[model samples]
Target: MIGYMYILQCSDGSYYTGSTKDLERRLQQHQSGDGANHTKKRQPVTLVYYEKYDRIDTAFYREKQVQGWSRAKKEVLIRGEVDELHRLSECQNDTHWLERYSSAFGCAQASNIIKKERKKDN
Candidate 1:
């Protein structure tokens, strides 16, 4: 059966991620405060984004994955900005892999190093 992974904007401006086999019914539950506790308290949700999956498990997995994302990351995803999503997915800390790999190559050569790194693993 087809499943849906969806993101909803709550009344207080928070985002809720969830998966359901019947999107319309699930949405109605959320709207009626009969859904997740988070959404129940922050009712009047609006569907902002969703993805369809062939299996319910896949949709549930996607829901779980997106639930851990930062608000900015979620926003970019909702906006359908794939490039921004990848850029934001990278760690910004000093010990980031990019920094470690680029240390020897220098910042100017980081893109080339990144390309090589992608080729090596993926």
Candidate 2:
């Protein structure tokens, strides 16, 4: 059965992401405040974006992925900015970069050794 991943713009301006096998029924449930707790409290949500998938699992996976995204990344997806999605998905952080660098160069233990050597030198 086909499934859908949808994004709703809530009454309070926040976004909610969800997946359903029956889009119409699920949307009605959200509108009637019988949906998720998050949407129930933020009622009167507007369907901002949706994507169809071949399998329920795929739709559900997409829903979870979208839920973890930043508002700007979600907006990029909602606006159908396909090209920008790749760019938005890239997360640059010092810790992650350092971990990657350390793993690549086998420097995970080198840091401790360098610290010890510096102490000895002092």
Top candidate, metric TM-score: 1
TM-scores of the candidates in the order shown: 0.79, 0.74
lDDT of 1 by residue, 17-121 (tens): 999999999999999999999999997999999999999999999999999999999999999999999999988654575687677778758767777767997
Q: Which stretches of candidate 1 lie over 4 Å from their true place?
A: 97-122
Global lDDT of model 2: 0.88
Score residue 55 of candidate 1 by CA lDDT.
98
lDDT of 2 by residue, 1-122 (tens): 89999999999999999999999999999999999999999989999999999999999999998999999999999899988999878655545555655776657664665557569979
Clashes of 2: 0
Where does candidate 1 have its weakest 10-residue lDDT segment? 92-101
Clashing pairs in 2: none
lDDT of all the models against the reference? 0.92, 0.88
Candidate 2, residue 32: lDDT? 97
